[model samples]
Target: MSKVILITGGSSGIGKSVGNFLTKKGYTVFGTSRFPEKYPQSNFPIIRMDVTKPNSVTEAVASVIEKAGRLDVLINNAGVGITGPIEELPDSEIQKNFETNFFGPIRVIKAVLPVMREQQAGLIINVTSIAGYMGLPYRGIYSASKGALELLTEAFRMEISNFNIAMTNVAPGDFATNIASGRYHAPVLENSPYKQAYGNTLKLMDTHVNQGKDPLEMAKAIYKIINTPKPKVHYKVGEFMQKFSVVLKRVLPDKVYEKLLMNHYKL
Candidate 1:
């Protein structure tokens, strides 16, 4: 029998692409959405779920088990994007972003572990971000949220290894998707000190997403990882420079890297 896969935020974007690809490859794929009804045209099943809601998470996982009898893979792809001058952004918005990006995956992971443990085999792919590797000009909150997930996976991997279940992180660089339109942008207040710089940085961030690589790249990468016998702790998918930036951060001097980022953002 083919492996059964469940992807949160599978109604659109990278999650949707991955689900479609896996389905075509003969995997029984299910995706979650807050409004599953909206995706009547989805190629795979869409489970009603809100990652931030505990009951919703449990119910979605349960629904998958009820139908599939066993779950082989879980993809934590449901996340939101937040961009703004960190100091200028409201605390509520920052917390909300973490709720979805960080806490949401944790909720789903916790829900599926028991089932995976009983089944004695499973794989989890956390959809993190390349932005998580560094604090970007106006995307500090986004970086922190995804960065937290990366760290969580590091620790969680060892804790769950005894169960024969595997966990990994997949950080993607900018991709051409509705994420730019969906992201929360703190208003550019004219009187604020960061007004000019923040506005320009916001435009740059959007342009990067608008002109970013295709989501298919991410889908193919995820499929390859799924087929691997033992997945690595972390994987990155994107253009050369985007992945290289992580390495650069590791090797470059602190102030020098800061200078490079400042110059790139024209700060």
Candidate 2:
């Protein structure tokens, strides 16, 4: 039987790309969407799931298990983006981000644990971001949310290892996706102290996304990981510099790295 793969947030962006690629590889792929009606043309079926809600997660998992009889892989690709000066961003937006980007993935993972344990063999891939590796200016909340998920995945891996259920976190750099359009952006206030810096930084971030690498790169990387018998705890996919930035933080002194970031962002 073809392996069954379930991807959350598969309606578009990286999730959709990965789902389409896996489908072409002959896998039985199922993608999840909060609004399944919007993606009637999706190659594979899309299950309705709101990772923030427990009931939705339960129903989505049950639907997958019922249709596939088993789930061989799960790609936790559902996430939202948030950007603003830390002090300026509303608490509600931050909470919402953590809900979708951090808690959301955890909710889905918990829902699938029992089923995977029963199978004795399963793979879980958490789609994190390269930003998670470091706290970027004006994107602290996003970085924190993803970083939390990354650490949680590490802890979860140790617990699930004995169950023959493998889990890994894949961090991708900027990919050409609709995330910028959906992400919340705190207005650049005219009289706020951070107006100038925030405005310039926001423009830069958007430019980076606009010129980001193709989503196909992420899709290919994920496909390769799926076929492996033993996947690493973490995988990073992106341009040389974006991936290297993570390494630089490790080797550089604290102040030096901060200076580099400030310089990069022109803070």
Candidate 3:
């Protein structure tokens, strides 16, 4: 039998692309959405799920296992982006960002672990971002949330290795997706001191994302990870500059790297 794969936020963007690609590759793919009925014509099955809700995540995973008899892969790709100066962003907004980008994956991972443990083998992929490696101007919360997930995934790998399960943190740079349109913006009052800087940085961020890589590239990378017997603990996908930034952040002097990042974002 073909492998059964479940992907969150599969109604659109990277998750959708990965689901479609895997389905064509003969895997029984199931994608989750808050409103599954919206995609009645999707090539792969759509499950009703809100990753932020533990009950919703549990029910969705249960439905997949009931129908497929087994789940071989779980893709934690559901995430949200928030932008603004750290001082201006409300505490509630920061929590909301983490709810989706960080805790959402934790909810889904917890729901699937029991089944995967019983099976004694499975693969879990957490779709993080290059922003996870370093703080970004106007996107500090988004970066922090992804960075938190990356660290959690690293620890999770160690915990689950004994069960013969595999986990990978897939970090992609800017991608041409609707994420920017859907991103949350902290309320910028007319009198706010950081308003002009926020606007400039946000505009630049949008420009880079608009010119970013296609989501298909990420899908292909995911396919290879699923097929590999032992995939790397982490995978970075994107153009040269983006991938190199991760390496530079590690090897470059702290002050030099900070200067490079500030210069790149015009901060």
Candidate 4:
């Protein structure tokens, strides 16, 4: 049977790439965006969804169920990144990051679980990041968000194993996507104490992101994991990320790993 897949934050970046690729592979792809009208009637039918809002998530799922009848896979790819030293960041910005990056997925999962449980088969692919495994210099908040998602996926996988539902956490390294530009920044950029300390790092972050792996490579890896006879709980998509970040993080000493990441980010 052709898989029916739903993806959040499908308007652009990796989510959009995955949606388009999956539709071409004969899967019925439905992507969610807050502005449903802005999303063209392309291969994937775009539905209005805002992960931070549980009601919006419920409405989106209802609409998808009305049309697709069955949701074979739900890809929690919606997320936002915020940068700054944890010490220098405001409490509100940090909370907002969690709302969009961590709790957003939780809301969508809650909305989709009932239907998937009743159907007795479904897959959930959470688009986490390499940051989930390691702490970075300026992206502490964003990393924390993904770290929460990683733990959530771990528990989700164990709890649903007997129910024929699979949860895979895709931890990709940096990719050539619009994430760097699209991330939200605090309004206190000019007046903040961290402005000088983190401003340059932010510029470097943007530059390095442009040099990252092709997003389509990660999209293909996601597709493969979904189609595998027995899917794994964790899937690392980027070549460099899978080679060094995920594997080394498990074996390397904490100080050594921290030093390596520090050097890479020039912190």
The local distance difference test score of each candidate is 0.95, 0.95, 0.93, 0.85
Worst 10 residues of 2 by lDDT: 226-235
Mark the regions of model 1 whose C-alpha exceeds 4 Å error after superposition.
none
Candidate 1 vs candidate 4: the lDDT winner is 1
lDDT of 3 by residue, 76-169 (tens): 9999999999998889989989999999999999999999999999999999999999988888899999999999999999999999999999
Question: Against the true structure, candidate 1 has what lDDT?
Answer: 0.95
lDDT of 4: 0.85
Q: lDDT by residue for model 1 over 196-261, one digit each (tens)?
A: 999999889989999999999999999999999999999999999999999999999999999999
Write out the backbone clash pairs for model 2.
none
The segments of candidate 3 whose C-alpha lies over 4 angstroms from its true place after superposition are none
lDDT of 2: 0.95
| 2 or 3, greater by lDDT | 2
lDDT of 2 by residue, 9-54 (tens): 9999999999999999999999999999999899999989999999
Provide C-alpha RMSD values for all models, in order. 0.6, 0.6, 0.9, 1.9
Once fitted onto the true fold, the runs of candidate 4 whose alpha carbons sit more than 4 angstroms away are 186-196, 241-243
